[model samples]
Every structure is written in structure tokens, then in C-alpha cells.
Target chain A: MAKQFGLLARFKDTPDLFHAAEKVRDAGYRKWDTFAPLPIHGLPAAQGLGRSRVPVFTLIGGFCGFWIGLLMVWYMNLYDYPLLVGGMPFFSPIFPFPIAYELTILLAAFGTLIGMFVMNTLPQHYHPLFNSEQFLATSSDQFMIAIESSDPQFNTEATRLFLEEIGGTDIQVIEE
Target chain B: MATTTSNLPTCPAQAELLDQIRPAEHKETPLVGNKRDFPWVTEKICTIVESRVPTWWWVAFAMALFTASFTGVGLVWLVSTGVGVWGLANPVNWGWAIVNFVFWIGIGHAGTLISAILCLLKQGWRTSINRAAEAMTIFAVVCAGIFPLFHVGRVWFAWWLFPIPNSNAIWPQFRSPLEWDVFAVSTYGTVSALFWYMGMIPDLGTLRDRATLVLRRGMDETLTPLQRKVQTAIWTLRKYGYGIFAMGWRNAGNHWRNYEMAYLLLAGLSTPLVLSVHTIVSFDFAVSIIPGWHTTIFPPYFVAGAIFSGFGMVLTLMLPLRALYGFHDLITQRHIDNMCKICLGTGCIVGYAYIMEFFIAWYGANPFEEFAFINRAFGQYAWAYWIMFSCNVFVPQLFWFKAVRRNAAMVWIMSILINVGMWFERFVITVTSLANDFLPTSWGYYSPTIVDIFTFFGTFGLFSVLFLLFLKVLPIMPMGEVKFVMPQADPHGHGFGDTAQGANSEMKGGAH
Candidate 1:
């Protein structure tokens, strides 16, 4: 463990943690977060986070996939050594609809996956929160709120006191 | 009573009438076990993966391994000798290979239907069974994929199906239905695998965290050299492997927001696939000009049968599993009943399609089509046709009786019957139509060689081996999703109050 990273406080349940989030938000701290074992219905609004951008990525991916499917079919059948088999036209749009539709879905699904990881900045190998043994409870049944040292208003003493005042227990100073 | 309506019995009579007319409470059972807490859910599901293997598991695994090896041997013999080893010949070019391919692929459909379709509809009962079903989907597809690849005879040249650039400028036929099948099946496989893994991440984190706790507690204890090495390996792999797959999931608000969106998008994407994949597969037959194969109704009929067979396979696997592992609490009788209901509904649709096919054949006024239908019922393959009818159409009707659906043994037997009936359904469609076609001279009897029989049986072995391995290695149930549905998981509920105190008592309770 390195030097002091932040003050990590554990909450007994979601309501206590949710209330503490409101308090933290009202206090004007920017670099703090709350963790729970499952998604709390109102936690995002409580933390002031906005709508996710994954849908936008999916839209763009669908359009690209559609065009790619069209081009691949057209190029193979119409442009490259067109040996006509059936009496139908070489680049009939009607025939390619199935492949095009499938590609649209396939790429859109990939976009959602990639966009999520990029947006969340995931595959993060380590974090100071992992250093707090109590913080592991966030993945199971406990809720936690961590105020990082990087936050503008963070003070080792003042943050600890604020957390204690808000019904937060097992407050520990996490080390990097 | 009428004379004093205003004064005597107005209030009391109305209240009594309302009570009588009101529907009963319905008393729907819980999907999971009663009185289950957060830790209990996690412990119950994860313990299956962590505990010592039972004797039955060993016996089943050995049987699966033996069959899987037979599949390998079958494939080797297939590639070494040629497609000649099978009963495929003039006029009847397609045989057990195509039948098994369609059968396995149809079986794979239920998994996606359970996970994606039911999920989108907010069918809460799906939470208990979707994880295992999705795993089944992935494995069944693997078994399904082998047939087409080896059926091409020159297995080495199977890559010609794809549009990749090559030294030879010859491209695959753009309008071929076979080409469309390649894309549809491959995309289905990839998407299913991704969906299954994405769902497993949180549960994998639970396992990883649990293993970490055990490791830390045992650090001071003495151990034999072998035990020490084993523990060290498990610790290292669990830490790194799970760490990467979990993608730093801390259930933070932002993470949850993104995860939910991604999951929903994937489900939306997969829903269409559940319909489209089999529809395209049907095109491989319907687009042809053969008498029995050229019907306009193939797509919808195929989809219905796919779902029917898929549910049958789910029941066949889940019923035995629920009994063996004592997962009745999680996989309740209600779940079994619901699945049986789906099977029955789809089976009825399939039966109607059968009747419609015969009607259309006679109504169309084509001699070949009429003869094809007549031959199917009265010809040499009539036995297979009747088997398909009884097993698929008649057997599932038993589910109408609540007693039959609730009886695990009865359901198990019916599921096996449905599976056999479905396989015969495909066999009937493929063999009967092709065996007796336009010219009488081209008509021949199609009997599957021993190789064909072994190869089909081998795929079942492969499917079971993969499923059994999945059971031992991963959380067969989705603990994270299961927890979400439990009463205690509610943020505002008393469950959290108990959880809070429990957290205080054990500092690391959250980690568990």
C-alpha cells in the first residue's frame, strides 16, 4: 500500500448510501462515487450522472454495417467477373436484404459492447478502492462511498468527519 | 332484502358480493426458494462450482467423454474415407447429416428465447434458468456447426464459403441460400457466446472474491506440498482471470447504467435473431423447387418447430438437473410448468402446420405435391411420419393436465419423447421428400449406415460433455440476477436493514 488515497466509508444499506450521495452532491464534491451490489433504481439521479451514450454508437454501427453488406454483395456479384446464373439482375437489392439486415444487427451489437467498455473506461486492473477490505462488500451486499484525494474539497480529516456524520460506518483512509 | 335495501343490508350485502365476485388471490409461487437472503443466494449457487464432484457427475462425465471420442473417430473416418461412408447416394443426396444439423440447431433456439425474448418481456421466472439455457444454446450450436463443415466432404476447402480475399478470384455465389446460412449461423454463434459471457461476469466476480477470502484465511496454515501448489495455482488464476473478465464491475451507478444499456441492446439484437436464423435456415429448403420442400409456409413452420424442440431440450436437461442438485427452490415447479406450457403451445402450432401442409398439397393441384404428401403417409417412410405426429403433436398434449406438468418424472419422459419426435420430424421432411421424388426410377430407400448413426449420437455426447464441464466450472445459475429478483434485494425493503447489521458484524460481508 502506498500513501493515503482517500476516505472510504461503508453504508449499511442503499437508503443510507443514497441519502449520503445527496449530501455529498449538495456538498459540491466532484471526484466521489457510490458502489452497490446491484443497480439502485434512483442512484444515477442521486449522483447527478446523465444518460449513457451507448445508443448513439449503436446507431452509427448499424448504418455502417448496412452499407458494408450492400457493397460486399454488389461487388461480388455485379462488378467482379459477373457470370450470370439466374435470369435476375446482377445487383438486385431485394436479394441482399437478409444479409444486410443480419449485418446491421451484428455490428450494432458489437458497437454496444465496445461503446460500453470505452465509455466506462473498463478493464481497469487496479484501483485504490480495492485496497479497502470493506470495499469488497460493494460487490456483494454492502454499499460504499469513496471521496478521492484528487477531489477539490477533499481533506483527510474533514472528509472522514463528513462521512461519519452522515451515518457512514467503518470509515477508512484507503492507500494507493 | 329488497324492501329494506337502503337501510338494512346495503353495506354488508355489497361487501359480501364484492368478496365473492373478486378473483381469488391466485397465490402464485415464488421463483426462488422461500426466505432466501443475499448470502444464501450467493452461497447456494457458488457452492455447486466450488464443492467436490458427486459420484453421479463422474459417471455422467465418463459416458459423455466416451461418446465425444466416438464423435472424433466418426469425423476422422468421415474425412479419411469420404461422404461415401454414409447412406447418401443417387436421388437421396441428403441424409442423417442434414437431419442432425437441423435438429441440433433447433434445440439451440430455446436458450436465446429464454434469455432474450422472455427477458425483454420481463418474465421474472427466466432469471433462475436463463444462464444454464444460454450455455446450452452455445454448446448446441457448436454441435450443430460440425455437420455442415464436415458435410462439405473436402473439409479443408470449407473456407470457400466465406468472402475473404484469396489468390483465386472466384467468389462465393452471392445469391445462394447456403451462403446466407453461413453468415446467419456464424453470427448467431458469436452473438450467443458474447451474450452468455457478458451475463456471467458478475457471478464470476463473486467466485473470484470468494476464492480470494479463502486464500487469505489459509495463508498462515500449514499444508502438504501438493495442496500448497494447487491452492497457489487456483489463487493466481482466479485473481487474474476473473479480474479481466469482471471488467472492474463494482456495481457503481455509472457502471450499472452502461451495463444495463448494453445488456438491453444485446437482448433487442438477439430477439430478431431468434426468428431470423431459423427462417434463413428454412430458406435453404423452401427456395428449392422440390415438391415437399417448396412450400411458402416453411419459415413460420420451422420457427415454431424450432421453439418446440428447444423447449423440449431445456426441460430434458433442467428437470434432471433440478432433482439431482436440489435446486427446486431456485428452479421451482412453476418454472417447469411454464416451460411445458411453451412446449405444448409450439407443438400445437407444429401440428396445425402438418395439417395445413397436407391440405395445401391436395389443394395446389400439382401431381408431384399430392403424390409427395400421399407417399409420406402411405409409403415406406410412413412409420417415421407417424412417429413425428405422435411424439410432437400427441405427447406434448399431456401437459394440458396440471398433474402431468408438475410431475418431474412424467415431464422428463415427455421431454425425451419430444426430442425423439423432433429428430424424426426432420428426418421425415428431408428423407421422405427426396427419396421419392418426380421420376420413379430416381426413388430409392434411404437407410442410414452405422457411421451415420454413430456420428449423430456422437454430437449428443459432445453437447453433454460441454454442458457438464460448464456445470462444474461456472455458476450454472446467475447469482447476480437471482439476487436482483429476491425480496431482500429491494433497496427500500427490510432485507437491506438486516443486511446492514450483518455487514457490521462481518466487516467483509460485502466482499462475499
Candidate 2:
């Protein structure tokens, strides 16, 4: 961690982040990030963060929810004291479907929310990213780009030359 | 350098000019770390839009109050005297009460339909109209609910509708269609209310951000303190809301997939419920061996009619109200066009149902059914039949043209006429069939008495009063959602082109 050199490139705004990122990537920097006061339109593509794995969790959640709903209805209607009227069949799926579908959705939704919170490492106590005072402006107005020095191709002189050539402003080294 | 930057003027003369013409300022509560000196809202704008309620709004509200009181008075007389006073005789047992109930409930379908359905379609137009429509849905459902509760003369025994069996040792006969109705209507009420409130939470937070101190205080009292603790309450809500209301909206990239899936599920669920509800209502007639009521097509036919009439009611309320409230930009010509298209489609479905019913009566070679259909067209209730025909079929035909569809006044008038036509259609269906069923000896003409008339009118009064109150208190539109829908919010275009200024700049090669 101490020996590795990271690339640092800052964008004055979100668009600058996008264009600068494309240039940096073309120049062969593998790992990087763009940050602004809010989510930027093209930053994710610039970071090369591929499609997320959130849906796999959601599907599993949905399946579990379906079975749980079925069991709840079964216990209440068939297991408990059964009362039948008008000769309608007991434990009819048509009648129970609304409640079942609602519960299935309820559980699945809960699972997805929890999964996202876990994956994002939310409620962080501390972050090395916060150590830079200039970075504090990212929460207010300025937009920034940080390319970790740890990438295989990262060389202090080469990366600094590359970032400056591509119109990056306020380049700096961020420590771990 | 830092001191110089701090000394820079907050707004130049040009920026102040821009602010004068187009108001822009953050009006949210001061957070612990806010660096800005003064908040955005000017004293004048706050005084006009957010000050004490104006007199005219109050006057209109009072009139609605008077109408509701009259309805209450009518109900008191109805309970004390009996069902006998208001035209529920032998052949015509169902009258104005059931008619209004079905009308109001049917009216509610449009709101949920617009919010849930269009959101799935990824239509940007929904942002403006969806907020008010959802509010209208809740109020209309409330209005519709009153009729069924009051229709049962023994109003005290309404609790019997629930599954709970008391000392009587009698379980509510699960086979009865009305019992299904109790579950369906109540469940619909619960889900719709939850969905509406969930949708409103973000908008309420937006209002919290934009509101004056007085308005903020009012909102604070309404929302739990815990709900207000976060600055990005609206953002957090959407993050979770898209999960809960949208049924686990993970895989942010596959937005279309999740949105489409959730929509299809809800649509599938609701379509059947829509069919089942009216079908059960029709079963009240169909299960009985009465000649006019024994048709199998009653379920789908009735459901189509319900959707038709419901859309009509929505257009009637939405068209004029949007104009009155200065929401024309949000509820645009395009929305009106889409609604008109649906109205025409459903209107045709209803027209087809009318024809099919007559054809079935002929095909079955049943004398009783034949006579019932013939009488509905040519007998004592012929006026209602023609009124239904003209409004449901003829008036809506104008929607086939783009010009008529886009014309606000024409569409508004047509929508009202369609509602009138729908009421007559229900009245015609319930009354004309029941009266003169098989035996001429029991045949009778049904007419609504003063109580029946007032009770139905009272429902309108109740619906208007609730809706007006909603406008005054809540953000009439979902502000946070509109902001999120802005091009600035979406990080990826995915497929569709972006719509906000931030996105526009990318197109023109400018600011991010």
C-alpha cells in the first residue's frame, strides 16, 4: 500500500469528469472515480463500474417471500379451525392470491433494500477519502476525479503527465 | 484567496433579474452545515401562495359542507324511517344508492390506473398529473364506500361483513358474492391508501423543503419527527419506495426490466380484481333466476362499463380542476389525448357489450330475456337507454379526431356528459332489468324519492370537500419525483434522451 502510486485527476464539473475520464482510459489508466455534489450523468461509465449484482439477491428474496406467504395462508385457513360456507372449496388460491402476492412483494422489497445497504457499506464511521480538505468541496459545488495509484500501469511521472495532458485540474495524491 | 471568494457578491443584478422572473432558491430547513447566508423564498411569493387560506376557497368549501350536511340529514331519515320510503319496491330493489356507490368507486380506478400504469410505461407526462390523480382516487373511493354501507338498512350490523363471528355462532357465508365484496373493497381501500401515502412521502418532503416557516411547522406536526430527521428524506424515501412500492427495484441499470416487471404484476393483479369485483356485483343479479339477470356475459360486460364510466369521471374532474389550479402545463394536451383514446376504446367495449347482450337474448330464445331487452330500449325506461347510448357511444365518438381530443372545453364537456351517460347506464341496467322480470303482476316503475336524490348528491359534496382539502394541505404535485425525473437525476440515458438542462448541455457540448 505504501509503495503504490495512484493517479489523481480532478474535473471542474461533471462533464469535464466524463471527457477527462475517457481520455485517461484511452491513455491506459485502469482504476479511477469521478465525484460531484450529486450523482453525475456519465460518471459510472467513466469509472468502468459494470452492471451491478443487486437483482440476483432480489430474485432469491422473491422466491423466499412466495413460499412464506403460502405457508402463512395455509396455517391460518387449513390448520386452524376450518369454517366452510356456500360449499366453496377451502384454501382456494384465487381467494388467497391477493394477500399472497402482497406478502411476496413485501419480503422481496425488504430483501433488496437490505442487500443494497450491505453492498454499499453504508453508515460508514470513517473514510480515508474524507481526509482531503479540497474534497470537502465535492459535497457542495466542485466535481472531482480520483484514479487510485495502485493500478498495474500506475507510475507517478507517467500518470501525472497523462492526467495533465487530458485537461484535469487540481491533480493530487490521496493516501490510504 | 478564500477571503476574496467569500467577499464575492451572492447575486449580480442580472442574476437578481433572473430570480425575479423565475423564482429559484433553496427553502429547506437550515441544516447544521449550510454555508449559504440567506434562503431563497422572497416574502411576497410566500405571502401569496402560502399565507392564510383565501376567502373564496373557504366559501366554496363551505358550500360543499352544506351539501354534505344535507346528505347526513337524508341518511338519518333513511335509517329512522326505513328502505321503503326511497323507491326500493318489488321488481326494483336496487336504486340510486347502489348507482352512486358503483359510480364513485368506479371513479377511483383512474387515479391508481394512471399512477401505477403510466409509471411502468416510463411516460414522463405522468409526473404532473399522477400526484393529483392519486389524491382523487382516495377521495373517490371514500365517496363510493358510503353507498354500500348505507345500502344495507341494518347499518349497525355492518360489522358482520368482517370474518369475525360473535356470540351468534354464525360465520359469514363465504359463498355469498357480497362477502367477497367486503374483502375486496376493504383490501382495495387499504392498499390504495398505503400506495397513495407512500407516493406522497417524497412530495411531502419536497413541500417541507419549499415551504415557509408556518407551513413547515404545520408539516412537522403532521410528519413524525423521525421522518424529518434526514435532509435527503425524499431521496432516501425513493431509494426505498422504489424497492417497496416497486417490488424490489434492484439492478439499477435494468430500470426498464424492474419497472416493466412491477407494472405487469400490478396490472395483472388489478385486472382480475377489476373483473372479479364487478362480476361479483353482477352475480347479485345473475345468480338470481330472474330472466333479465341470468346472462353469463354480465361479468366482463359490467367490468368494461365500469372502466368506461370511471375514465369519464376522471376526465371530468381532472380537466376543469387542472385548469382552475394552473396545472395545464403538467396535465398537458398529450395527457388529454391519451385519456380520450382510452375513453374511446372502453366506450367501444361498452357499446359492444350492449349489442352482445341483446344478441344473446335473441340467441337463447328465452322469452323473458327477450322481453327485458326490448323493454329497456322501448318501454318505460327508454329515456335512460337513449341517454346512455348517446353519451357512452355518440359523444365519445368525437374523440376519434385529434382536434376534438385536444380541445379542452370540448373534452371537458364531453367528459361530464359521459359521466351523466354512465349514471343513466347503471340506472338503466339495474332498474330496467329488475322491473318486469318474469311476472307482470310484480312489475313496477322505480323512481328515486327526495332522500335518494339528496344522498347521491351528498356523495359529490363529500368527494369535492375531501379533494379541496387535499389541495390546500399537501403538495398538489409530487415535487421530488418531478425533480428526480429531470434529466439531471438520471446518470445514464440507458436508451431514452434526457430532458433536464444538465442533460441538455451534454447535447449542446456545454456545462455538466
Which of the numbered candidates is closest to the native, going by highest TM-score? 1
lDDT of 2 by residue, B1-512 (tens): 00112344456985676556732343432111111111111121122334456776798799989888878988898899987767788778888877887777677777766776666666666665676777877887788787788788888888877656566755454445566566666656655665565455333322322332222234454556775554235434433332233332111212222222333344334444445556666766677677777878887777777777777877887787666665554566777787888889989988998888899999999888899899999999999999999999888899999999988889889988988988888788788988877788988998999989888888778888987787665556654344334333333322123332343444321232
Model 2 RMSD in Å is 12.6
Highest DockQ scorer: 1
Q: Give the per-residue Cα lDDT of candidate 1 at B43.
A: 75
Q: What share of the true interface contacts does each candidate keep?
A: 0.50, 0.03
Model 1 interface Cα RMSD in Å: 8.1
Worst 10 residues of 1 chain B by lDDT: B1-10
Lowest summed lDDT over 10 consecutive residues: which window, candidate 2 chain B? B32-41
Q: Compute each candidate's TM-score over C-alphas.
A: 0.91, 0.67
Top of the candidates by lDDT: 1
